[model samples]
Target: MNHASLDDFLKHGTATLAKGPVALIFVEDAVELDSTLRHHLQCGFKAVVALMPPAFELADDLEDTVHRVAFDCSHPQAVFDAVNRVIEAAPGVWLYYGYNAEYLFFPFCETRSIGEMLAFHTEERRDAMLTYVIDLYADDLENCPSAVSLERAHLDRAGYYALARPDPGNHNHPKERQLDFFGGLRWRFEEHIPAPSRRIDRIALFRAKPGLRLRSDHTFSDEEYNTYACPWHHNLTAAICSFRTAKALKANPGSTFDIDTFRWRKSVPFEWHSRQLLDLGLMEPGQWF
Candidate 1:
């Protein structure tokens, strides 16, 4: 069902937010919106919320399945606003958020439902799951100017690294169990990408509670929610295979002309399986066997 505005959705669409494991997909543009929604839906999310501009159209199947909200995605802090508002409305729900052309993949996701993974996480007392935004782009930008193509998607097999996330309030000491992850196209083409947006690590899958806020850096207001793992052991992590960065770099006139191709020797075809990400060490299964 389509709502005129975000407030309208919150007021009238409360039923959609009643359940846990809901996906909040913010549509930045029309590209691959349907595929992104379908992916999450197939992952067995109880509900999928599509926040997009009113001008965009949705497939008939999706129109009936997803809760559509007319939102200004271009506005600054739009993601933060929409997410936090939903968090306030749906406390105790598992919430996941991402942009168009982004796909979430957890360990054993091919056979296991996202709900199953989250269940295991909850059993371990983890309230959030760390996800790396792995950059995906078409092998050739000349034909596919937007740098997106599901059939020909390519991602860097290496170059992923993490640094200690400093705590400014505590004399710049590294935040325990937290690291600022960086890599993919953002790291390869740093000059065109802003420093703040470079980190690919995001606590994308989280349980909402009162006063929970999604920070601009993709971390959370609650410090524990931002941690990569429990102090006891490593926790399950996911990967968001995304073409958003590639699309942006190629779309932006400033960087478009400068980038001839996103492919390099390290670039490899994305197999679209959780095992590939696992083998590459992009994500971990933790103790979930």
Candidate 2:
């Protein structure tokens, strides 16, 4: 069901949230909406909610499987409000949120469903999972003018780095277990990206509680939920292979002229498998086999 606002959807569209993990895909543009839905459905999310512009059209095939919500993605707070409301309505349920053209990958995701991975995560007493937003761009911009192509996607094999996340309210003591991740398109084309959005670290997967809030920075109101791992060992991690940034950079008329192409020497074709991200250290397998 389509809701005019996030409040309307939270009040009405979350009846099935408790059944299993839910993926809230916010669509900034029309590119790859069908593939995004198909990927999440395959990942075992009980409900896949698509929040897009009023003019956006979902594929005919997704009419029955995916839920549609009318939203203005330009307002970042809209996403946070929707997630917080859903979590409040169904505490302890797993939820994931991302933009269109972003695909999730976990270790052994080939043979295992996301449900199985979350089950393992729950056993370790973890509420949130760290996800790296690894940027993916088309190999030939001319052939794939939109800067997106599932078949010819490429990602950076190296150059990813991180620094301590600062706590501005606390005189830079630094937030525990949180860091600012940077790499890929954003790093290569830093001039075009806003400073606040450069970090690729996202607590994309989490078990929601009633009072929890997803902050504008993509971190949760509860500090522990922002951690990279548990106390004893590293918990499982996921990779969101995405073309969101590349798509934005190329679409912006101001930046388009400067960016001849997204490809660089470090770039390599994405293998479209969990093993590729694992070998690149983008995501962790943890204790799961």
Candidate 3:
């Protein structure tokens, strides 16, 4: 059911908050909304909460399973507010957040459920999961003008790189166990992308807790949660195959004429599996059987 605002939805819509491993999909646009919801559901999330504008209609196929909430996603704090409130309401629950065109893939995600992954994560004494926002674009944008087609999706196999993340308080020292990742469409079209928003590393999966806050840069207020890995070993890192950046670049008037093709020599067709992402070093799986 739809609520008037984020607050309204958090208060009324989430009657079954105790259900763990909820996927909050904040839809900035309606494109691929159905597929995004379907992917999360198939991954065995107990609930898939979709936050979208009031008028945007969810596909009929999703009405039975997906929870629809009415909220504007344009505001900077819109996603953060909803997530923080949900975390407050349901502490200790596994939570994940992403956009419409993004799909989450953990190690062996083809066979394992998100709940299983979180269970393993909890055993490792971790509260969050690091996710790489791997850009996926239509190989042939001519046929699919939206710049997103799963059948013809392509990604840069080798453009991925990382740099030391600066500490928020002091630029002199780098943040421990944290690195700013860059690549994919955002890196390829750096001229069009603002410098501040280039990093694609996000703590997309986490356990909800009191006083926890999701920052604008996709980091968390609690420093430990923002860490890339545990003390002894790297944690399982998920990949969000997304067409959001590609779609935005193609849609934007400023960049449309300049970008004749998103593909370069390094571009390769996405295998649409966790193994491909793992092989490319786009994501990591630590001590996960």
Candidate 4:
């Protein structure tokens, strides 16, 4: 069902937000929007909320399946704003957010439903799951100028690393169980990407509660929600295989002319399986077996 605007959705369509495990997909552009939605829907989310511009068209079936909200994705803090509002309205619900061309993959996701993984996480007392935004791009940009192609998607097999996240209020000490992850196309082509936007780590899957806020940095207002794991054990992590970075880099005029292809020696074909991400150490299974 399509709502006239975000406010209209909040007022009339919020009944869809009554359940848990809702996916809030922010459509920045029309690129792979249908595939992105279908992926999350297949993950067994209770609801999939598509916050997109009214101009963008959705597949007939998707229009019937997802709760569509007209939103201006280009506005500053658009993602954070929309997500936080949903959080406020759906306290105690599981929430996940991503952009177009981004696919979420958790350990054993091929056979296990996302609900099963979140159930395990909830039992472990984890309110959020860390997800690395693994950059995906077409092997050749000449034919696929947008740098996107699900059939020919490739990602960096290496170059991913993490640094201790510092606590500014505590004499710059590293935050416990928290690290600022970086890599993928953002790190490879840093000249064109802004420093603040380089980190690929995001607490994408989370449980909403009163006063919970998604920060501009993709972290959360609640400190614990930003942690990568519990103090006792390593927690489950997920990966968002995305073409957003590659699309942006190739779309931007400054970087567009400078690159002919996104492939490098380290680039490998994305197998589109959770095991591949696990083998590459992009995500962890934690205690779930």
Candidate 5:
């Protein structure tokens, strides 16, 4: 469809999406939704929702722009109906990721447009989607040897950037020691998210290789035998570049980084992006709606 048609289609869905680009969060129990909502808003996510509303008006207040859908499998047909209800109202793209996320600390490229993301290839999908979730612990903090591989930055040409919040057990009960973040399983996302019309590329701060290594402790290591970001960790940047390179090359070439990957000894750090938050005064607390 043409640009005008796309714009008209999106206008119809504004009710559900509100001022999105949004994040579709799925939570179970004991997690307070209020803190989660505040964090998402602070992180720049447009809206947050519960996958299974806890049978309370507080969670499913749709007029407020957040949402909750019950997981009553007894009513199987209703699931499809609700999916349609949300889809019909949500415009642009839906990022089915969590507010407490790991990828946020890394480089990210937001999908430029929904139509472009739909067309990415399978090999490109992982590179474009998943995150190499890290489990950081208190004692391990002092031992933080850099996680690097291939010397080349992993690229994802079909993914969007989102945060992965850690649970108490994920880090440490007090949550003061370390954290456990998730990279949503690949197939889990086939439906919840939408495709983009054009790709966007955001480079990653982590250096990576096409392969992984397992440490003596049975943990994952990179080509260099150290902790590393999986190819997918690069997020939208890899997704976009891979897609464009594939179109030009005329076929999907597995994960497009290298037959012979290149690297820079002096790598850039991901924390640099935080300056934007500092500059805009977004780092401070403000009014919440």
Candidate 6:
């Protein structure tokens, strides 16, 4: 990393206890964000939340540092503008993030330069695994859009959770702040949030497919989504398991079928995929380390 980058990280981070904010972008419901904020805070995330088309639930968060900015849902640009507004307004008070975003920091390592990095510590091995993840998404220039984006980011691999594409996309590049050599990278660059780096059992893009224009009803966890004020939409992804069961029934209609009884790849080892994680063992904090 360059001096400027290190300076920015220290200036923007430090007290926040990590690097980068986890951003949760939702149109109406804020329940999941509420759960996630609590989860990360427990896991040591000093998070900042940004929401649009405001809801009262945001006000209920236990963290005093969480912030909210409201915008019209019809205009997605306004929502993003709200994010920029907060980050721009508070240059570096704390690591700023929206609803579900959290920070990832490399506090374990003290190597200051690339030369020092070559003497690989166990931490370096972990960073390499995360880099390989980026590479997996990048290798196929076509057919693999996520990989392509990571390749373009070219984040400093000598760190934990190197920055990837920002949430939504790289649409907002406020013209005023332009570092000549850095402009392109800054365009849609995301601040890297720390993760296990190598221990990510699963990489899920929940409800992220474009064409699956599911209604509020067809959308996963709608019942919980509707009663979010009362908090009925538990962390349980109520849709996925049922969907899997339904698919099985469609393929084999004659078998004695009960959604409750149906299970697929159930006995697999340490499964993190939705289908398998339904009964996967719980992970205590810092288990991967």
lDDT of 6 at 229: 16
The per-model lDDT (C-alpha) reads 0.94, 0.88, 0.88, 0.92, 0.30, 0.26
lDDT, candidate 1, residue 79?
88
Global CA lDDT of candidate 5, please?
0.30
Runs in model 3 deviating more than 4 A are: 168-171
lDDT assessment of candidate 2: 0.88
Model 3's C-alpha root-mean-square deviation from the true structure amounts to 1.4
- Model 6 TM-score, all chains together: 0.28
The TM-scores of all predictions, comma-separated, are 0.99, 0.95, 0.96, 0.98, 0.30, 0.28
Clashing residue pair totals per candidate (backbone < 3 A): 0, 0, 0, 0, 27, 10
Kindly indicate the candidate among 3 and 4 with the higher TM-score. Answer: 4
Stretches of candidate 4 off by over 4 Å are none
Report the number of the highest-TM-score candidate.
1
Q: Give lDDT: candidate 5, residue 155.
A: 26
Q: Which candidate tops lDDT?
A: 1
lDDT of 5 at 176: 24
* Pairs with backbone N, CA or C atoms under 3 Å apart (clashes), candidate 1: none
Could you give me the TM-score of model 2 versus the true structure?
0.95
Q: What does candidate 4's lDDT look like per residue over 93-121, in tens digits?
A: 99999999999999998898889999999
Ranking according to TM-score, highest score first:
1, 4, 3, 2, 5, 6
RMSD of each: 0.7, 1.5, 1.4, 0.9, 20.3, 20.0
RMSD (Cα, Å) of candidate 6?
20.0
Model 6 lDDT per residue over 1-289, tens place: 1112222433553343232333333333332345444533443333434344444354354436543444343553443444333344333222212223111212121223111221222222211101011111122223332222222212212222223222223465432211111111111121221122222111111112212221321112222211111222112111011111122222343532322221122112221122222222121111122
Error of 1 at 34 (Å): 1.1
Native-referenced Cα lDDT, model 4: 0.92
